[model samples]
Every structure is written in structure tokens, then in C-alpha cells.
Target: MAQIGLFSSAFFTLLAIIFCFIFRRQAWIALLCSSLLTLGLFMPVSFGVLLVGTTITYFLGNKSQNSSKIGVGIGILLGALVSYKLREIWMDSRSLSLDDFWNEDKPWQIIGLSFFVFNAISYLMDIKRGYIKSTDSIFKLAAYLLYFPTLYAGPLHRFNYLNEQFDQAKITKKSFNNGMRLILWGLFKNFVVAQRLNQLQIELRQSDIGGWWTLLIGFIFFFYLYFSFSSFVDFFQGVSEIFNVRLKDNFHKRVYLSRNRHEFWRGWHITLNEWFRDYFFYWQMKFKFWRDKPYILLLLTYLLIGIWHGITVKFFIWGFLNACWILLEKRWKIPERMEKNNSYKFLEIGYHLLICSLLALVFIFPSLEGLFIRIGKPNFLPMDVFLFQKRNVVIILAMCFMVDQYHRWSKDLRMDAYFESLPSWKRRLLYLPLILSIIFFGVFMKGMDNYYLKF
Candidate 1:
């Protein structure tokens, strides 16, 4: 493959300046600036592919003027996700490294391209259905496709939701404050909390284990990972809202607190959940003929979701497992006994925790990532990860969940007339500490990679 030349930061900045002038809009500039930020950070091949994939999808969606063709194009594109993503796997099978592109055999460097493809295909599908009207400009579509913030690991937003953020409403003082707060919050969650937990996760993953107690400890580590990750989502959403560019949020404060599988899916990675529902499940439910075939529909939709995560056996099983739970819930609803009985609540929580931990292990052991190996892998005392969960890690994990719990009951922003009712001096004192915390911790913690960068 030919090497794509890098564009300087100034180029994107200039693009931002020109668009800002023409559109008279801050969001347009903010999003274009996002792409510029990405070009600088991401490798050239990755960024090049993303720009091409997104812009092409947008243009085709606009010109085709037919939903069915768009759907087929999207299906073919989604199918290509595996082919592009699994270059390393194909090379491994052949026992040869080919210089197909870049000449460097970096297996782990797919760079979230598959995820972007998914977004593109979904956009095309939406356009076909008239959910998304096509964009006229290549630049704006480029901004939507390669906007760096959501690109690394996405809430996987749909074009319908994305186009809605093209609001011409003034970027109010409130939006600015909220955006800054969100970006700062994202930094704290990603660099501080998530990276810290990953250290423990790496160690525990490498070790061996056995017994219910060790398994319990393993589950605790997994919990920290979720906390660290979900925190990243909240932080970025806040940042996007600052630019008046709203992306879907994956973490819901409601889901973890949910008592059943149906509600849990509602709260988890909400965009993908909704994507599967809309593209696959919703239409079937709308048609009378397909009511009896709910199981097959459920099976296929979730299987696609699982495979989208990666082309691994474990990922497929993960999807299947989730599908079964959802189907069981669909067929029998959350049993009234399970819902009301206080004793079952603990079991339910444990079940949720177990499912989450096991799902996470798919990423933990990618090479041995199939059903049999996942079951057989050493999970033991001296060999097990919890044989050594550190003190600092335990403390950080505590803080991670403590924050999530706080948000469970708290809003990110609140302007009670009561806060205005407070004495000025008292309000100042309260705001002082928060301001200091954000500056001291957030500003200094921009050190590690965002977990989603690997796609």
C-alpha cells in the first residue's frame, strides 16, 4: 500500500478557521478540530481509511436514493469489517507476513477501523430508510466520520442522533461550562481511574487460580475495569456536549442498578443495544408473521453484535450467552417472584457480576479465546491473579465504584434555586474545592492511552 502523507496541525486548524467563518457555527469548527486532533494522534493508514470509508458511505447514501441498495451495501461493508480486522489472523494461518500495507506486521493495530466501518454501514442503512438525509459537503461528512473523540472507542452513535446535534441553537454559556467539565471529567476517568485498574487486571489475568474465594476476587477486579471504562463514557459525553455535538452514551447509571437482564441491556453500551434493536429486532416485532420466530431473530441479532466486537469464538459465545438471557427474559418476562423476592436480588447481582467478569476475559485471553479454552484456562492460588491484588489497586477500585455509586443518585449538573438560595460565601466555598480537584487531578493525569484506541 502507498504511504499517505501526514497533514500538519496547521492544515486542520486552517480548515477549522475557514469552516467557522463560512458556517458561523462553533460546533462545525469543534468537530473539524476533532478530526484535526485525530490526524495528529492516529497513524496515517488508520486515519486515511476512516476518512475514505466515512465520506464514501455518506456520498453513496446521498446519491443512491434507494434504501434497499443502501442496506445491501451496508451489509457488505459490515462483512468486510472482519476481513480488514483479521489481516494478522490470515497471515498467521499462511505462515507468511505480506507487505499488503505498511509492511509492519502489527497484529494489534487495527486502530478501531472496524468500529468505524460499523458506523458507516449503520449510517447507510439509516439513509436508505430516510432516517438520515445525506450530507452535501465532504468536509462535514468527514467530520462526522473521523471526529477523534468518539472514533477511538465509541458510544457508536447513529447518524439520526448525530444529525440532531447539528442544532443551530446558540452555544450558550451553560454549554461551554458543561463541555469543559465533561472533558476534564473524561481525563480523570481515563488516565487516572481506568489505567490504574488495568495494572491489576494485567497481573490477575496472567496468574492461575481456583476455588470460589479466588473467583470472587477475580470478579472484583473485573468490576473495577467496568467502573474505569464506564467513567470514560460519562466524561467524553460531557466534552461532546460542550461543542453542541452530542454522541450516544454507553454507560447508563440505571443499568447496573437494574434487577433484570432486559433492563441491564437497556443500560449497557446503549447505542449498540439500540442499533441491534432497530436494524434487526424492531422490524420483526413490527411484522405479524415473524412473532413466532422471535428466538431465531434474537439469536441472529445478538450473534452479529458479538461478532462485531471481534472475529473470535469467545466473542461469538459472549453474544450468544447474552442473547439467551435476553430471550429467556423475553419469553417469560422478569418473573414476579424474581423481581419481588428480596433473597433473589443477591443472586441476581452475583449472576450479573459473573456474566460481566466472564465476558471481560474474552479480551483478556485473545489467542486462547474460544469456549473450551475459556473454561479450561487456569483461573488458581499461586498462579491466580488475586494471589497478588495490590493495596493501591484495591483503594483505587474502591474510589472507582464509590464515584459510580455517587452518580447513581447525583446529577452531573444542577442549578437549584436553592443553590442560588444559598449564601454567596457558602456557594463559593463549595465551588472552590471542586475547581481545585479538577485542576489538580485532571490537568495532570493525561498520560495513558484511552482503552478504546485498540477497537
Candidate 2:
């Protein structure tokens, strides 16, 4: 029931691994039971809601042959999702503090409901399209919906992909080694990199630093957001792989190297964007009006994506700005034009980096007014204000950037594969420092919650 990054969740994962090996071909049953038990322990109310939602979705898919009934079912599910969003918006609008109303113990604070609901919707849609059939086995349905590794924030996998692997899933030596390596790398990113950046941001904000420091905070937040998000995916995907359940790769390593907004999105949150593209954008393109006036639909799609993060004005602005930049790039053929002059590569990269860092301000501040106030503030803080030494921060960031570049260069091969190809001495030399950094600098005591957990 504990979140994936927590020690308790790791213990549960270890147990699940042992249980799966003992059961052999029936490993899926052990997986399902462990998943359900974990969910029940962490969030019993949410777990009950998940079961009810999954059961309804399963039956609705079964009865989907009746077109009218299926329409009603789809509407009901959408309505529920909309209602949840509205309730959240209302809570945000209220004068009462969120702590006074919403908490982990509250029934309305359903963790991962947004993600699983989207999965359920996609399941029903896939059934209607005849791409996949609804299973008669409720247990399999439960396993697919409530798979523990992805039950929190997810790579947003499809039912067909996971269901096919469940029965045959088992840990091999290669998988175990790869999974452990991923776990260690993820720990380093989250604890050593992201958390330190978080501390720096907090210190800057408390100091009310402005000018270049505000811009630096924005840059810090961009990397912080990336590491906080991608690390969760890496850690959980590693755990899932140990069970031989391969989840979708969420982040492309080249995301930060992107020269434009469109290219950046293709590399960042790859699964979520693909989900919107497949289920929403393509579905709209079926209409002649949407096809003819595609940009209008594109803008609307992004607005929906923004609201999906949270029904807030700041998010709406963030989505709108992103759509505008993307549209500008497409209409002007910016990236294509820039490609002709190789000398302009740095200019192109800087342009995107600046835009993205500014856009990150929307997420880092609670309100647009607060963001402007900070940017407009005349005073500044000295480098001495950093919790971790500023020089150490720079060194860590540079190291990460260099590693990412290497990953980009070897995009054809997986990181685990590249590691395995190295001699034992080289491998030990590489991972030994990484393990030490995590052990010394990791921020495990504060909390294990990820940035995306709210969504």
C-alpha cells in the first residue's frame, strides 16, 4: 500500500517476486493477490472504488454489443470523471484550506483515480473498436486495472499489452540485474538530484530572490520536474520488469535536447501524450470539420490535456502557451528552416530552453500574480543561500547532462544492454560512485511522494 519509492513498498515488491517464483506458471495469481493486498493496505477506500469502477467497466464492455447501452455507459464514466474534476476545482476555489478538507484518510481523496479511469475508458473504447475482447475472468480484469507497480502514477499501459504477458511473466537473471540497476539509477536521480533542487527552490522562494535568481529557479524547477517524474517511471518500470511485465517507456532521454516545442513533447511524457493523440485527437479527426480545421482541434486537445493536470487557470495558460509555440513552429516550418544552417543549432536550442524555463514558472508558482511579483522583484540573494553548495549543484547537474548526452548518442541500445556489454571492472567503476552518491545525498526521510502523484 505504501508508494513505490518507500522502503515498505520495496519490501512488498521483494515479497511479490518471491511469491511469483514459488507459483511458477500461476505467477499471475500471486501478482494479483499481492497487488490487491497492497492497494487495500494503503488506501482501502480508493481500493474499493477501483474495484467498483473496474467491475462496471468490465460488464459495460461485455454488454457493449448494444450500441445505445454502450453510449450510456461511456457517458456515465465521462460524467463521473468530470464530476471528480469539478469537485477538485471547487475545493481549490473555497476559502477553507485543503488540509482542513482533503487528506489521505478522506474518501474523496482517491489516489490514481484519474489515471485508472483513463485506462478504463481506453479499455471500453478498444472493446468497441473490436481491437480487443473483454475478458470473462474478473481476476484478470482486476489485475490489469490494479497492477501495483503502475497503480500510482503510470506509464499508462494498455490492457492488451499487459494481459498477454501476465501468465508467462517470470523473473530471469537478466531481468533481475537490469531491474536492480534501474532502481539504483532512479534512486540517485530522485534523492540526489531532484530533492536537492527542490530544497534550493524552497530556499530561493523563502528568500524572495528575484532577477537572475528567479530565472535560475525556473531552470532548477524544469530539471526538478523532469527527475521527479522520470525517476518514478524508472523505479516502477524496473520493479515491473522483474515480474516480466514490461511497461511503456515514459520519457525519451533526448527530451531535454529538443530544439522545439513539438519535438520536446514527442520525447517527454511519451505515453500520456500518445494516449491523448490516439484516443482523443484521432477520434476527432474522423469528422471532416476537425480534419479541415486541425489547428482548432489541436488547441482544444491541449486545453483538455491541461485541465487533465488540474482544473486551474495556470494550467490552462501553460497549455495555451505550449499550443501557440507548437503552432508557430508548424506554420513557419521553424525547425526545418533552422536545419539548413548548422551554425544556428545553438540558437535553436537556446530558444527552446528559454521558452521551456519560462513556461516552468507556471508550475512552480501557486498563481500567475505570485510568479510576476517574483520576476519583477528588484532584490536578489547571494549564492550562499543555497542549501547544498552552488558549486556542488552545478557539478551534479553537469554530470547528469553528460550522462544524458551519452544516452542520446546510443539511442539504439537500451541503458541496461549498454551496461551489460561493458567489462565487469568498468561496470563496477561506473555504478560504485552512483551507489555512494545515493547513499550519502539521497533525501529519503522527508517523503516518497512524486510530483505527478497529485495528477
Candidate 3:
């Protein structure tokens, strides 16, 4: 069933590529409509029924002048999303409990569902506060939910962003060149590096190793998966730009350069992080219970951040641990002058990575039991995974980091623009290698499924 579903989706994706070329002006609508149509074909359920119901509800929900009504409507959709546990539910597996109503499956089809939920709630809240005017066209609203480039793994987009391209029709050579590069880059990361590293990660986890060192390799792979997958976000964001749909870029380099936990969260998985801060955190801050006691408010904020990712026992512990880390920073009096010293700069980098790694380790183990069992056991390894290491995964990792670092230090932003600005001869030299590498890696790789697709 899974293979059948995957095969059909790939077939439809090829068709989507053709439509994208043909309907250049309406590419956003075409891309999304194709994805939605594909979903209906594979979904077994009627897209019309779901579309009509969601559209009507979204319109009626936004029509309200009262803040509370919009809040209630947003809350209901959020509740359905949460109840569905759309993130890690198993489809086709035997039911372990009654809550398997919305398992992970092509038929259930929660693609872009999380992004849509956040965007809708934001749209509702924004309308109530006058930050956004409701689009009268149900088609436009539906298109926003289904926009294909971002729907799989977002650069979380918004309606206002889409509004600018309303009548634009040109797909210039520059746009096509840049867009193809990005799409190819994304496919390379998704299909090549991340997938290969993931298999090794699983092998390390399931292996019978006697020490904490092997456990360290698990976390290293953790970082690899994150870097490779998140780069996909950049890749798609670039491709979407070619179509003139400027999707938001989700990563900020400041995460690598962050001075503290507070700064670090702002940089990582940033769209969702800021989404929580603005939508959930600020919303909670209005009350006297939260406002009067700052410490309590801080604790609740981090806890909410954790649970927003997943509602599980480990998620709560992960959230609480994060809150503790934040509160410690607040209570500690690290002098500002001393913090700037060279040693402190070193300390700050170490501290941020440790915090990120700790939080990420919690992410590794899904339950409290799983987390505890893995803790105190070192997992790092210089293992001879000959297949991966032989394939130059190490070299690939170094190159990926080097390119990212170069992008950071280089004053001229936008790699595409920078490349275009190069001398004609120099430009050809640079372009040939990038183009060749894409063809080389792309043909040989067995790409992974979208990581967020699990969620």
C-alpha cells in the first residue's frame, strides 16, 4: 500500500512539473491545485467535502468582529490538529488505542496541515487586530493552504506574501536559473546526504554497543539530519522564489553565532519558534497571573514551546528542562563586561551548543523511559560504516558547513546574486561545477522521505 501510494504521488509530481511550466502566471495556484488534486486521488476521502467545509468555516470564522469568536474558531481547528496527532501517528499498523483516527498515511493527508493551521490562526488573529484584511476569494485562501513548494516542508508562507504576485506573469531566465539551482540543491540534500546518514543513525541506535561514546554518534547524526533537512527549506524557498512566490526563509545564521539560550531559540526552526512566541506566548502574557509573576510566565512559555512540537511525556520534560535553563540565565549575574572577554565568547558558544544538544537529545528519545535509558550512556563513535564514510559523507559534511560559513562571513548576501555579479568567465567556471555536482549526486542518491512529513 505504501509503495503504491508513493509511486502514484511521484507520477503526479511529474505532471505538476509540466503544469508549473505551462501555467507560469498562475504557478502558485497550479502547484497547489495539483498537490490537492493528487491528495484527493490518493486520499480515498473526498477533497471537495473537506475543502468546502474548511473554506466555509474559515470564511464564517473570519467574518466575526469579536476577538473571542475568532479565538474560539482558531482554538477548534488547533484542537482538531492536536487531537489528530498528525505528527507521528502510525497508519496501517494495528490500533494500540482508540486515538488512531488520524494516523500518518497518504489517505489521511496532513501535508501542509500544520502550516495551514498556524497561518489560519494568524490570519484570524491578524484580521481581528487589523494586521490583515480577509481575502474575499475562497479560492485564494484554499490556494494558500495548498501551495506545493512550501507545503511539504515550509518556509512558512503567509497570504500577504502571496498577494504581491497577483498579476505577475514573467518567468525570466534569471528566475528559472536560480529556481532550478535551488530545487536541485534541495533534492540533493533530501535524497542524498540526509537519507544516507539516517540509515547509519538507525544502525547505531539498534546496535549493541557497550558505552556512552556510540551514543555521541547518534547526536552527531542528529545534527546532520537537522542541517541537511533544514537546508531543504532554503532550497525550496529559492525554487519558490523562481515562481515569484516569496516563501519565508526559516533558518537564521545567528543560531550558529548566538550569545545565549534566548538568542538561540530565536534562530532555530525560527518560523515555528517565532510563531509560538507571537501567537501563543504573547497571547498568554496578557493575563495577570502571567504578568504579575515573571518567573512563572517564563516557565510556562518554554513548556508551551516544547509541547507545541509534540504532546508526550518526554516533550513536557524537555520543555521543563528548557525553562530551567532559561531561568538559570535570568537568575545568574554574568557581568556584561566579562561576557565580552575572549574566554567568555568561547564559553558562550560552548553553552549554546550544549543547550541545543541537550534539547535535541531529549528529542531523540520519544518517551521519558526512552530518554532515561539513553542518558548516562555515551553514544559517540569513530565507527567503520564503510558504505557511508567511503562515499565521502565526511567530505560532504565539511563542504556543507564551509559553504554555510562562507555565506555567513561574506558581506555580499544572496549567493545567486553574487554568482550572477561575477565576471562572465568566472561565472561560467563556478556555474559548471555547481551544475555538474547536481547531476552527479542527484542520479546516484536514494532520497529520504520529507522529515517533516513524519510530523
**For each candidate, what is the lDDT?**
0.59, 0.77, 0.61
Where is the poorest 10-residue window by lDDT in model 1?
A: 1-10
Model 1, position 326: C-alpha lDDT score = 79
Per-prediction TM-score, please?
Answer: 0.77, 0.92, 0.81
Q: Which pairs clash in the backbone of model 2?
A: none
Backbone clashes in candidate 1 total: 8
Candidate 2 weakest lDDT stretch, 10 residues: 1-10
Best of the two (2, 3) by TM-score: 2
lDDT of 1 at 447: 48
Q: Write one digit per residue (lDDT tens) for candidate 1, span 255-346.
A: 55567777677777787777778877986677876787878888989888887765666667778888887787767766555766778787
Query: Candidate 2, TM-score vs. the true structure?
Result: 0.92
Write model 3 residue lDDT over 156-200, tens digit each, in one string.
655676656534523567776766655555555554456555655
Alpha carbon RMSD to native, model 2: 2.4
> Judged by lDDT, which candidate is best?
2
Cα lDDT of model 2 overall? 0.77
Candidate number with greatest TM-score: 2
